[model samples]
Target chain A: MVKHKIVLLFPATVVEQPFLYHLVKDYNLIINVLKANINPRKEGTLVLELAGDKENYDSGIHFLESRGVKTVPLEQQIVWNEERCTQCGACTVICPTSALEMIRPEMTVTFNGEKCIACGHCLKACPARAVEEHY
Target chain B: MKVNRTYDEINERIKKGEAVVMTAEEIIPFVEEKGLEQAAREVDVVTTGTFGPMCSSGAFLNLGHPMPRMRMSEIYLNGVNAYGGIAAVDAYLGATEIPKTDPANTNFPGEFNYGGGHVIEDLIAGKEVYLEAYSYGTDCYPRKKLGTYIKLEDMNEAFMFNSRNAYQNYNVAVNLSEKTLYTYMGILKPNLGNANYSTSGQLSPLFNDPLLRTTGIGTRIFLGGTEGYVSWYGTQHNPSVNRSETGAPRTPSGTLSVIGDMKQMDAAWIRGVSFLGYGVSLMVGIGIPIPILNEEILRSAAVKDEELFAPVVDYSQGYPYGRGGPLGEVSYAQLKSGTIVIHDKEVPTAPLSSYPKAKEIAEILKSWIKEGQFLLTEPVEQLPSADSGKKLSPMKIRSRGEEN
Candidate 1:
């Protein structure tokens, strides 16, 4: 099984469709939405994490593209500039995952890339603007 | 075992290259492993630090009298206004004072690119700043108006005098309402989506000197890369807050009002910052060295993040004081874990204070003590304890014809 984060853009016509339901039932995939902004009869954007077998994941993407829905894989990761970072724990508090933490005694920030979900919480919370999103 | 040492004795040892020094970060583990008795005897001075936004801070500059001296009534420094209420040629540049064009609360605060704090930073960097002053023109001081440039060195006595700073501990801020909130704690996502905690935790000045035992009036400190003194107890200093057995406040408690010479400070240590949608503030770098007078002092300095806890407040409500009640008391360890369980819901966490910068200040102070350039001054008076029953009540209006 593979886990993939992707953004789905739905046009006004497909806003009423059960595209997500079809992906789960047909491809046997597990879907967890990170963010969604959708309005009826308007353009909608969705950020979701999908977990399924490689073949099924491929089929789901193909299926989404065929329905006039734009499916874009999420490849953005947070980049922390050490030179600019004051090691304030601002990013650690908002991070959904335990990716940013203050090491004891020394009292410095340590970033674990593997645990980061790229939620972009740190990007907004960082006062120094040291954390950036890079594809 | 009890430890005994004096400031003079410590200095004497330092003069003979026999004194032991360590940063608060370095001494904690050593004290834990070696025992307080041994560690207290081995360590002469332990430097503690905190780097956080201190809004109640500003610099007073005595600009040398221009060609013709004038009692300036209005003054602007680098586009940001300064209070010229003092004597002629003297001005106080508040940290939060912004430019007139960028009136605070008139529009988005993020649009304000610079303020008085930036002017101070520029001055410390050896950069010249535009100065504009106006007066009614007195006989002795004839100049009505003047526009020129000035540097920090040109000012006769430029000193940073913060009214309130070094908060003992602070609250962990979060938003519980549907709408997002912009605050000094940074932007809080709607519905407790994320929690931002500020403070250096154990590395903070007051935490290390809990109860203000060794951090009261006349205590020498490292303020913005220079030597400074604790002038008095900070404003709104409510020592009557809840505290742990080790004397560490569970909430915000004792604070320090400090004064330091700006001429001895460096630009790298002091910074001006704005919280985007929030207002402006000054990022002050302060380090206070705690002397190991006894085992109690050693034990207090050994307090860690796990032992410290702060209330996670809901900022969606009107002022932090009226944020209802806290979700619960959360340790710094749990706060730094990125996910705190509040009301059975997981909330993300962040911090506004810079631990990295705090650590750097601690290290810098350590080096200064090791080099025998910095000597810790024993506080002349200990701060009043919480049991003092000092109440700060709001002023009430007097009724018409009320008896005295």
Candidate 2:
């Protein structure tokens, strides 16, 4: 089985569609949502970790694109500036997944992008403005 | 046992390589092992440090006198505005000022790419900043306007004159509502998702001092990097805050206003920061050396995070004015553990202040003292310990025939 972390952007018109349900029912894929900002009559975004057969996952992604949804990987999104960070550890607490942490003795803040859920909590919490979200 | 080493005596010992010095973090364990009386006699100096975002900080600069001298009524540095009301050649740049590109009324966190704090950082980094000024032409000095670039070294006098800093202790923040919060305390997650505190805890200057005994006016300190002096009691300094038996405040109290020359400061110790959807502020590095004058001072400096307690306030209730009340008191050790329990639910904790940097500053100060490069200064003036308890009166319109 292959696992992929991706974001599904739904245009305001497609906000009512149950795209996530179809992934589990029709595509036979496991969907663990990391974040969801779906509101009626508004553009919606869903970040999910999908796991299934490689062929099934590929087909599911193709089906999502065919339905006028935009897909982007999590890697292309966030920027963490280490030079400007004072290692205050403000971002580590609000991080839903253990993406950010403070190292011992020196009290430096370390970020592991692989574990990040992209909740954007650190963006505001940071007094140094070291964390930035491009998308 | 009476232990008293005057500033001159301490300086003499330092010169003779006989003075004993240690960081506040290091002296605690030594005092615990040797007892306060012994430690007080042996340890000459205890260095205290704190690295945090000090919003009430700024710098005053005296740029060179321009030809055909003009009174600068308007000034901008690196595209950020500076207050030119002081004098024709001097200006004050605030730390939290929003840049001209993003005026206050613009929108949420409007394009705060650079600000006054950034300009200060750039200046200290030895970068040239564009300066622009406008003034009404005067008969004695008829220059109408001027524009130029200025470097820190080129300015006649540049000093950080912070009106308030080194807070004795502060509140820990949390959000109880369904929505999140962004504050100087860092981000507070919804439904107690997280708690944010901004202090170095045991390593903070005020944390070590507890009471305002040794850290009064004229106290020499390591501000940024160069030597600085505590000028006065900071604004809103409430020494009357209720405290625990150990002397840690249950509320905000005892603050210091300090001044230091920018020529001696290093850019690495000063920085500009922008809070997302909030505003810009300065990240300052301050280190204070506390002399072990007696057993009382030694005991106070030995206080640890586990023994000190702070209130976890709910900021979602309306920030500073919120009446949601304190959830509970927790020690710095518990908060530093990365997780806290609020209302019987597990919540993670984050710190806005850099304890590692605070430790680093203390180490730096210790080295300076050990090498006899930094000397301790006895306070020239004692800080006021009593609160005036005076209330601010609101402006009222005069009634007909009233106060004729």
Candidate 3:
């Protein structure tokens, strides 16, 4: 089984649809919602951790897109600019998760996208401003 | 029986590819195993390095005279203002200088995306930088203003004359307040959630030559990327500080003014960095090679991170308001260990200085000397020591009646 962190955006028209229920019941996917927000326009946005087999995960993603829901990998929203990074490790201690860590001996910072909860601590912690979020 | 080495002696061995050279970090272990005397006799030179955000860094640029000579009274590089009071076409672009349009701290924490330091990095990287200058038409210089793009190579002269570079030691910043604090030392989490320090510890040049015995004015060094020289004692050079047995300062003390040609520098060594809410600064890579003149010099050069200490100051209160002294003191070894206990609380530690980059710089300088491409120089004058009578004083605010 593969575990993935993703975000789903539902347009106003389909905001009330039970897409997550269908994925768990029909596609055999496990849904762990990290955050759920509904805007004044009635659009629903969810940050979730989804776990399922390969075929089931693909089918689950397809189901979301089949409706008016847009799926995006959670890691894709956060960008760590390697070229601009000085590898000073100021963000290493600030990251709540082990997403940002110092690779010892070499002392360079390595980023693990899967582990990042995108709490945005590193964004302010980095002296080099190497970490950024699109949304 | 005395063991000693000279600049000429070490340089000869380096020229012959026979010099026994090691980095500051390497000398520490070698001294422990072989003893200071033996290491002194064997090691010809101990190279030291540091890479940190130096806000006192800047470049003096002489963007060649415009089409019809203009005595520039004001100038901007990449939208960031530079000091243009030097001469007709010369200006000093400081690292912390931001554009006039920058909202700064009005929004609490400014992004500080681009500034003077970025322009310097862009120029060094062979990138085109927008240049704008304004002046009143003069007799010898007719042009009023000029707008153009200039590269480092195209400039008449470009050099870095930093007023202060490598600090001998520095404070380990932490916040004791309930709110998070943003500072030049990086962000300090509330209630000392985390601590931030910015020295390379054992590998640092100033720490290696704690007393400033061999590393001083006129001494050759690696600045940015190419060879540079220590020009003078940096501003705020406080030598009247507590010292270790090896003569290393216990707190923030000595600093060096450095100069170098910007044309020969590597873009990788000279970078532009931002400190969240603080501002922009240049991350400079500097290395100083200390010739093993005697066992005493060797003994100081071999000082380790465990022996060097930095004061843990509360940035929110003690620092800005000068309310009181540091909360406590911690060794560089402890600072580098990822965590330190303060007031029985295990506070995670982070370093703004990169140890790997410092090691890389030391290795590069070692290679340059080993290949005979570089040679050691005896400093014409030494820096002030623990008894130099140099005192860093606070400025007195003046009133209208005060003398100009």
Worst 10 residues of 2 chain B by lDDT: B386-395
Model 3 fnat value: 0.63
How would you encode candidate 3's per-residue C-alpha lDDT over B306-384 as one tens digit per residue? Answer: 8999999999989999998998999998988888998899998888998988998999999998888889999898888
* Between candidates 2 and 3, the lDDT winner: 3
Candidate 2 residue A135 C-alpha distance from true site, Å = 8.6
lDDT of 1 by residue, B1-404 (tens): 57888789988877676678887778878988998899888888888888888889999899889887888889999888899998998999999888887856666535345787778878888899999999999998899999999988888999999998988898888888898677888878798878888788878888888877788889989999899999999987888878888888898788889999999898878877666666667889999988888888888888888889898888877345563676789988787666788889998666678777888899998888888888778788887767787644545568989754
**lDDT, candidate 3, A33-70, per-residue tens:** 87788999898878899999999999989989988799
What TM-score did chain B of candidate 2 earn? 0.93
TM-score of chain B of each: 0.95, 0.93, 0.98
Best by DockQ: 3
The TM-score obtained by model 3 is 0.94
True contacts kept of each: 0.53, 0.77, 0.63
By summed lDDT, which 10 consecutive residues of candidate 1 chain A come out lowest?
A71-80
Which pairs clash in model 1? A88-B354, A89-B351, A90-B351, A93-B349, A93-B350, A94-B349, A94-B350
Name the best candidate (by lDDT): 3
Q: Candidate 2 DockQ category?
A: acceptable
Docking quality tier of model 3: medium
TM-score of each: 0.80, 0.84, 0.94
Q: After superposition, how far is residue A125 of candidate 1 from its true place, in Å?
A: 4.9
Cα lDDT over the full model 2: 0.82
